[model samples]
Target: MNLSFKKPSVDTCSKCDRINMKLKYAFVDQATNLKTLKEHQEAFKAAYEEKKANKQLAQSSEVVAVITFDLQQCLPTTYLQTNVAFYKRQLWTFNLTIHDLKTNKAFCYMWPECEGNRGANDIASCLYDFIINQLPNLHPNAKKLIMFSDSCFGQNKNSIVTTMLMLVTRLSPQLQFIEHKFLVPGHTHMEADTDHALIERIYTCQEIGTN
Candidate 1:
């Protein structure tokens, strides 16, 4: 990965001389809070380097994909009887986000109206369906799979998920290797978070308009 910073260069041509740059603003202090600022910069740099490396590696015939899955808690519109007079029903949404390292494309699958309890079996079932049914259509040439998920015991990072991946490798002729990894317990911020945020934002907008 290229670690050298590339300063913005000026374009010469009149028709295509426009410069495109993106600036991100966040509150950071380097005076007394140098540690925090440095940590943030290191994290950002690490992510950038990894992405660059993935892009370079994706050009090969080996297909590279990073997948993240999680369940989102959502409040339902209807109500039901409970210990209290009435309570709004709650639902769980299983969101699977796949980021193709080669093409830098993101795909999201949301399964709504899910039951409250989510175990390894449920997670494995959803992943299996995607792998066997949907993934081939999306990336027919992909042979190796890499998956990332939170360290939650019941939802992911368990024997069930490992078994599922192994089964895929064994059953699918196109798949050669499968690897599943658990993100740090508190540091799992990936594409799935962005997917969840978008869903939440859309739901919030709908609620406001309805009101």
Candidate 2:
């Protein structure tokens, strides 16, 4: 297998794009946009660096556990690569993936469309159960948690999830604190993404049907 390692630097950030566009076409105040763009990029780099440092610390010490979670793209309930399948309606399946940076272990909280929707409540419930019930048992020595995710206003970044985490920290005696951080909006490629890629590989190769 001829493989060459490549660093992924996808330019998909909306802020970056908008600023670049304004600069390119001379739309806005050039000085202001340039300063804003520089600040945004610096913040992006700083976030990545902080996550990196936290991961190393979590791996070395048991006091901290670093985790990143993401909701995978909805999967078709019954799928076949054919024209007939395209015309037919399909049930949707949702999965939220949580990956531990220290252990490289991933946990998937999944459900069918009939069972649940992937909204703020759905996400918060899953997280609540995991943090309150499972996380401590899994990482007994982890007293602090550092979590990373995208800045989706509806899901992870909203008031509901924030309040849930605040409550979780208070309710769970094992946890001293929880720190949640958002990765750069468009550049949130994470460890869970690799887990999803493996799942996708197997998913696409096989057929799924309701019995």
Index of the highest-TM-score prediction:
2
TM-score of each: 0.62, 0.88
Model 2 weakest lDDT span, ten residues long: 202-211
**101-176 per-residue lDDT for model 2 (tens digits):** 9888999999999999889999999889889877887789888999999889887899999999999988988898
Candidate 2 similarity to native, TM-score: 0.88
User: In candidate 2, how many Å is residue 72 off?
Assistant: 0.7
Q: Candidate 1: where are CA atoms >4 Å away?
A: 1-56, 59-62, 78-116
Question: Each candidate: what lDDT?
Answer: 0.61, 0.88
1-211: candidate 1 lDDT, tens digit per residue: 8578766332232211111111123233424344544455566556545645544655565565545566655434422235552443455455556555555556665666554246788778878987898778766888777776667898787888888888888898688987676654444665566666776667766765652
Residue-pair clash count for candidate 2: 0
